[model samples]
Structures are given as structure tokens and as C-alpha cells.
Target: MENLFSHPESEPEPSQQDDDALEPFIITVVVPTNVSHAFQGFTDHPHLWWPLDQESVFGEGSHVEFEENLILETAEDGRTSVWGTIDDWQPPLSFHASWYPASTPLWSTEIRVSFRAVEEGTEVRLVHDGWEGAEDPAASRASYAEGWPRVLERYVRFMGGAVA
Candidate 1:
């Protein structure tokens, strides 16, 4: 469940004029399953592993659903929120999306997740980019940098990893 690759520690500040200069936040983790199963576990059953009760737009008692073109999070109270839009979806391989959870699409970033076969299991690599759309890209990236590891820890545990 450890990252086999790492990026540079120092990253450039993102600006609307120079958005492409900012490097995407990349993280990789190996899951104890094949590519297809890992892909299904992430796209089809996020509600089971995602920390919906804690880090979600609807707060506690929310569940996620990946629709044809959207990722929806619905609360127990019946209110729903759009987390992202599926731009490109290729099962058992990779998918790209515009992510804007808890906000409008106008301020969306981008996410790409890929699943590849490895010696141990499937290597799930996540790349978060497109900071130009955010009002405060650096802050958003920093926040997610802190948050994604925890979220992926939950996912790794769900994927049968001995994650502590």
C-alpha cells in the first residue's frame, strides 16, 4: 500500500495565467486485486470505502453513486450533490473527470485514475490537476494533498491491504 513513485517536493504556485506550470498531485497505491476488480471497487462501490460520513458535501449518512455521466452523493435526508462529471470512462483501465465536489462546475479541477496490473496486485494511480479553474488552486491542492492519503488509506483497507 505504499507509493512506488514520488514527485518533486517543491511545486510551483498555480496561477490563472500559468496554470500549466503547476504539477499535478500524483499518488499511487497497490491494491490486493486485479485491475478489473480494482476499477469496479472504485467506480462502482465508492460508498463502501469513501469516507462519506466525514469528508463529504452532505456530511454524515451520505452515499455515492456513479451514474452514466456523474458522480452523485446523496444524503440520508435525500438531498443529493454532484461530486464530478465523467468525461472519459474506460473500465479496468482509466477514467478522467472534472471534479468539483461541494462546489459548482465553474470551479472544477480534473482527476484521472488508472489501474494497472503489478506483481503484488493492481497499482492504482491518481492524478489531480487542472488547477486553473479553482479560485485558489494552491490552497485546494494543499488541502487535497493532505486529504487524499487519508481517503486512499480507507480505500487501501477496503482493497484488502494491511494499511495502518
Candidate 2:
């Protein structure tokens, strides 16, 4: 049975292809807060907004936080997982990080989030890129495309804003 599943010894190497053909996933939202408050809410209060029960390594009781240069998720039992690391930590303006939830840094993707004060409130933009680094760039991008919007909706609600 093991031999039946093995690849042929004469199989040719796969061709190298450009994964950058996939565009970055971008999302923008306006919240009823100033830029500074928006940034603070995103960075300092993710534990309150994040859907830990649905999107966590330990589920339900797990909480996530941004500390120093790392985004960490800690379970009720005290076990922690690193979801990502901060590549840039500018406040009230923008921040960049490499996100790799439930995966290794070797397959990481880049995330950049910016906040700007607008007439209505604050404009927050998120760009998730670097698809070339992902193991299955298209599938990875698709999963995040579905997941990020839900996550951002939670953030928007936490900021006391409606998704328009």
C-alpha cells in the first residue's frame, strides 16, 4: 500500500511559477472614533474583539493580544501561540506585521494596517500581501479573504461603529 502511494522515481521536477500573480487582500472600514483611538482599539484591545472561540488555537477561552513586537494568543490553561510578529509599530498611523496563524514563519504573509482621521470618523485599511511566501498562495489567500472580513466586523462593532 505504501508503494502504491509513492511517486514514480522518474517523475520530473515541478516547474517554478510566480505566486505573486495573486493580488493582496485589502479591506477598509470606517469607525466612529479618531485615528488614535482606532489604532489603540486595534492594537491594544484585540482580546475583546477577536473571535477566539472560532478562530483560536485553543478555542473558546483563548485570548489574543499584541505585546512588544508579537501578537500572541493564550489559552485558559496558559499555553500561548504566536500568531504573528510586528515588523513595524507606528501608532495612530500604521503598523506592519507578518501573519501566520496556526502555521510557521516560513509560510508567513505580510499585513499592513493604517488608520486615518476622516470626516465621519476614522478610516482603517488593512492589506494582506506577500502571497509568494505562502505554501498554497491562492488557497491561503482565499481562506483569509473569507476570514478577515468577519474579524474586521467584530473590530468595527467593538469600536461602536457600523460596517458601511
lDDT of each: 0.89, 0.90
Please count the clashing residue pairs in each candidate, in the order shown. 0, 0
RMSD in order of candidates: 11.2, 6.8
Model 2 C-alpha lDDT versus the unseen true structure: 0.90
- After TM-score superposition, the amount by which residue 47's alpha carbon in candidate 1 deviates from its true location, in angstroms, is 0.6
Q: Write the per-residue lDDT of candidate 2 for residues 1-164, one digit (tens) a residue.
A: 56877887797765544434478899999999899999999999999999887777889888899989999999899989899999898897999999888888999999999998899899999999998888989888888898889999999999999766
Model 1 weakest lDDT span, ten residues long:
14-23
User: How many backbone collisions does model 2 have?
Assistant: 0
TM-score of each: 0.85, 0.86
Model 1, 75-100: lDDT tens per residue?
Answer: 89898899999999999899999999
TM-score of candidate 1 on Cα atoms, chains taken together: 0.85
Best by lDDT: 2
